[model samples]
Structure formats: C-alpha cells, structure tokens
Target: MPSESSTLHTPAEARVRPVQQWWALSGRGVAKVFRNGEFVFAFVSPAFLALCFYLPLSALMDVYGVDYAQFLMPIIVLQSVGFAASSAAMRASFDDTEGINTRFRVLPMPLVVPMFARLSTNAVLLVVSLVCAAVACLIIGWRPMGGVVGTIGLFVVALIVGLLLGLLADGIGLMAGSPQATSQALVFPTLILGMASSGFVPVSQFPEWIQPFVRNQPISQFVDVMRAADTGSLTWEILRPTVWWCGGLFIAAVLLLRLGNQKVRA
Candidate 1:
C-alpha cells in the first residue's frame, strides 16, 4: 500500500505525453536564448557583416560592374543562418557537457523529445536571424529584384538550408564533448567553404584551375540558385544541384543525430 502522499502524485502526473514534453522543453530553450542575450547577437552579426564587407569592398567590386551590396546579400543572409546554427551547436554542447541530456534521458519522455525541443529553438532563432539579415541587406542597398513568387522561393530555400544546418550542428555539438571543441569543429568548415564559394565573388573571377570546384561546390550551388531566384530567373537546371546538396545534408544530419542519440544513451 502506497502512502497518502504518494497517491497524490499519480502516474499521469509523473508521465507527460511526448508532445507536451517537447513543447515544455522548447519553451525552456527559447526562454534561455532570450535570457542569455543570444537574441541580440542574432541581429548584430548580420549588420556587422554587411557593414564590414559593403564598406571595404564595394568600390572595388564596382570596377567589375558588380552591385556589391546586392551581390553580397545572399552570403550575408546565409551567414546569419550559419550564426544561428552555430549557436544551436553551442547550446547542445552546453547541454551535453552539463549533463542535461543525461538527465533528460532518465525522464519518462521519448528519446527524440529533447532534440525536437532544441530544433524548435533553432527554428525560432533562424527566422529571427533571417529577418535581421534582410534588414541589414536593405540598409546596404539590396532590393528584391525577384517578384512575389520568386521571393517566396528564395526564403523557402533559405529556411530549408538553415534548418538542415542547425540539425547537423546540433549533432556535432552533442558529439564534440565540449563547447570549445564544438566551436572549433565548426570554424574551419564555415570559413573555408564560405570563402571558397561563389557567394563572395564571381566564379569567373577565380583562377582557371579552381573555377570548376568553385562553380560546383554545395555553397556555390546554393548561392547561384539564390541569386537566380533573386533575379526572377531561376530554372530547374540551376536549382537541381542545390536540391541534391540539400538532400545529402539532410542524410548527413540524420546520421549525426542518430549517433548523438546513441552517445547520450551510452
């Protein structure tokens, strides 16, 4: 026979539905992001990037007939997305290092509930970062050359890419063992891929030997597709590579997430 006090705490009280657990955890994550000043960085980073690049290189790019600000918008936006994803990684790493995930594993919720919550927090941050990026772009002379449909397509692509990147980063964080290690893991890929891609300059401007690689890389593909979408000239041929790259990223993210789950259980 249980004590009267134990009877007051029923099984229903002890066990929440997965959805409820997920929502509660998500709320906690979202609140933490705001409370910790991550929200301010979401706005500041894009603005800083826009100013740094647009001021120093705009004149040089003009000599080549490039509207540098307009040309730079996609990358700026992508950088903001990247920033959000990196923050997601940091959050996940902190949770892992602090044993929060281990505590969650001992709870009655499903294994995926905490991941879903982190993802939800990432989604919110992604959207905020995108909006901030757009505002930064506008300040630096980027305009929507794409009409309604094309503009919609541009953002849809960005959202998908951001979500996928966030998922991958979350897994990387979980596997990294420490916050500093997770950040170090992300730095090389972000810097190398960002600088090597078509986002910063025209593919034709690169050395002939590197042109093929520059034109075909995933970041380059995404940038070209985004540029085409911006100008209302998007075609299936232009978008095909982006689709494939995104598919590959999705697969990678899934595998990383699975590994992260296993690590938590261990």
Candidate 2:
C-alpha cells in the first residue's frame, strides 16, 4: 500500500465532465430561484398584469372593435418574458458581485459551462412564466382562435423570443457591476419598449408622429408576428422584421457574452 504522503501527492482518478459541471450549476441556479421566491413572482407578475390592464382597458379597447383579451395576450406573454430576463440579469449580477463567478473560474470547468447553465435556468423560468401568462389570459377571456397548429406556432414564437431576450439579459447582467445596476439598466428599456409598442394599443391609437415608431419598433414587430400566428395569418411580410430583430438580438448577445467572458478571465 502507498504511504499517506504518496496518496496525498497522487492525482485523483475521478474527473468531473463538462456536462456534469453544467448540470450541477443549473441545479444550483434553479434552487436559488426557488429559495429567493422568484418562482412565486413568476406566477404573480403575469396574473397581476393581466388583471390590471384587462379590467381598466377592456371597455376602451372594445370601442376600437378589438377583442381586448385576444389583443392583450401577446403583450402579457411578452411581459412575462421580460420578467424572466430580469430575473436572469439579477442572477448574473449577483454571481458577479458575490464572486461566485470568480470561484467557478478557478475550477476545472469550461468558461462556457456556467453561462449555459444560467441559460438553462432562464429557459425553465421562461417556460413557467409563459404558462402562467396563458392561464391569466384565459381567465381574462382570451381564447385561441388559432387552430392547433396556429396555437402551437404562437407559443413557439413566444418561446424563441423569450430565450433570445433571456440571452441578451444574461449578458447584460454579467457586464453590470451590481444587481441594482442590472435592474436599473433593464427597467427603462423594458418599460419604454413595452409601453410605446403597439402591444398595448394599436398604432392608429398613438399620436401621428410616434405611430411610425410604434408600428416599426422591434416589440411591435414581435407582437405583430405573434398575433398573426394566433390568427393563422402569418406571412413573409409580417415575419421579416421580427426575424431581423431576432438576428440583431442574437448578434448583440454574442458580443456581450464574449465581453463578459473576457471580464471574467481578467
């Protein structure tokens, strides 16, 4: 048998695989989300949004010949997406500030493992948020006029959009110095985009000058695609802008993530 000193000097045979590292980190993230009460907020936020907007504005929207519940579903889903992205940002910021990221860096894990793990956590939260939003929309009288395929397409669009947003937000969180800064950085854009978009009301309802912006903005484009998917009227023209926006978001996320990786290594 080897002496105690020789055993201590020997390299261990056991090695942690990259997939195991990713899974472990993802489990940790999911646990943190539950422990921090973010999971509860995932349900509450969308339901509250649906109630607040549908109650006050349904009659007003009816004046425009809009089925308000149907008109409102996309925005509610998108808002939930925003909520998930915000949570991701906060998680990334906390990891950075608390030195959790630095600790991970010192481990034998790949640089991308933690990022992918966070993305898995974000995806899980996004799915929950979308489900909660759907329940809230149903309670508010939204029904799927979209056939089976159309309805599926609607959710597929929502999922893709949510995942892209989560990626962008994750990068933002890593780049931000603190959780407060992360929240602040996300709040304005989320508010301005959500409010100013045709998501709440039609472009015709906006002031003439801003109507142009409202009609063409990325959020509006997303809303338009989702609505079209719901009604089974999605066309190349309706989808083109959203595709472009998704591409832009993807590029931006990649750049930010690369920068974040550099910062971590530094």
Candidate 3:
C-alpha cells in the first residue's frame, strides 16, 4: 500500500521512535558531516595549522629565549579548539541548506540528536587534529613540562572551546546562508582573539589600555595555562581568567545554538 518513494524509508527508520532513540539521530548527525569533505583533511590539518600559523609565530618568539614550541603550544591548542568548533557550526549550516535538517524534522528523531551528534563527531575530529599538533610539536622540538595532567588539561580545554566555537559558527551559518561567510566569521575571531589576547606577545607587551581589557580575556588565560603546562610555570593569574573565558564562551555557544535553531527552523 505504500507509495513508491515510501519504500525508501527503512523499517528501522519507522521504528526509531522520538525520545527513546535520540542516539540514533546522533548517528545520523555524524553520518551527515562525514559525507562532506571535512574529515578527509582533519588528520593532517594540525601539521598545516602549525606550519602555516603556529610554527612561524613561535619562531619569532624564539628571540625571548623561551622555547618557541613551548610558548606557542597553548596558543596552538586553543586555536585548534576554536577553529574546530567553528567547523561544527559550518557543518550545521551545511545540514540546513542540504535539507538534512528538514529530513530529520520530518522523521521521528529527537531535535537535540542532530546538534549533539554533529558536535560529538567534530569533537573526535578536533582531538585527532590536536594529536597531529602534538606530533608536530615533537618534530619541532617542543616538550610538555606539565606532564600528564597538563597535557590532558590542555586538550580538554581545546575540546570544550572548540565545541562552543562550532556552535557559534553554526549560528552564523544560519544567518549568512553560505559556507564561505561562515568560514570568514570563524576565522576573524580566531585571528583577533588569538593575536590580541595571547601568543603574539605577552599581556605586558600591550599598551596599558589594551592590557586591562585582554588581561582577563580567555586567550590570555588560556595561553597562561598553556604556557605553564608547556614549561612547568604556574600562576594564579592564568587560572582565574581561563575559567571566566571558558564559562563565557560556553554560554555564548549555547545562546547561539538556540538562536541558530530558531533562525534555521523559522
């Protein structure tokens, strides 16, 4: 009795009831992103991220006599995390335009599954990219003095921050209507925040005005945490600021997710 097109809906699909099968929806979310070309480059991107951006900047900082890779490691970790999150947002946007989201809406799947699953998939991808960065660090003479705890902490921060950035990117994608614009929006914050808040120079290097503003900013705090972890330097200055930065970004990401969903669904 089914229509010819209805045959395309598997029996499994019909049985995946709403609330009970949220995880199944996540699987679909994961599948959708991998279908695109993004994952193909994820494994190698850390090398590119280092060669194209982190290494060059670290080399410049070598004049300070601090280890180039050491000084740069935290910054690189944060950058990767943020960039990864932005990619997540872009992926969400892609789903919207491709009609993937529409399909999900029509199905019995839970709404949260798509976003969360997409996020989870990207998280794994970003972690792999971070590992690639770690290998690059080894190749370029960087060492992690923070030992196991610091190393773990750095990656953890990266994942959280990356997830948020992705959400932010997703929101933008909803508004901008294209991948290119989503990418630009993602890159701008990474550059501005990365350069002005940390890595390029210490907070002391900035003028008194810019110093106060960024002193408590996330990148500065993240760099401080990373700097310490990379070199075994410890300070309260880094801890408090990083907590604020993480919390703030997390809130922003959640808010953006809500806003993006509304925009896209509307």
Give lDDT tens digits, candidate 2, residues 1-266: 89997786555422447888889999999999989998899989989999999999999988879999999999999999999999999988898999999999999888999999999999999999999999999999999987998889989989999999999998999999899999999999999999999898889888998998999999999999999999999999999999999999999999998998899899
lDDT of 3: 0.68
Candidate 1, residues 199-231, lDDT tens digits: the string is 988998899999998889888888888899999
Cα displacement (Å) at residue 129, model 1: 0.2
Clashes of each: 0, 0, 5
TM-score of each: 0.93, 0.94, 0.80
Question: Each candidate's lDDT (Cα)?
Answer: 0.93, 0.92, 0.68
lDDT of 2: 0.92
Which tens-of-lDDT digit does each residue in 30-98 have in candidate 3?
675578655655645556656666556666666766566666666666665665667776777787888
Angstrom error of the Cα, residue 62, model 2: value is: 1.4
Q: Rank the candidates by lDDT, best first.
A: 1, 2, 3
Q: Which pairs of residues collide in model 1? A: none
Best-first order by TM-score = 2, 1, 3
Candidate 2 backbone collisions, by pair: none
Worst 10 residues of 3 by lDDT: 17-26
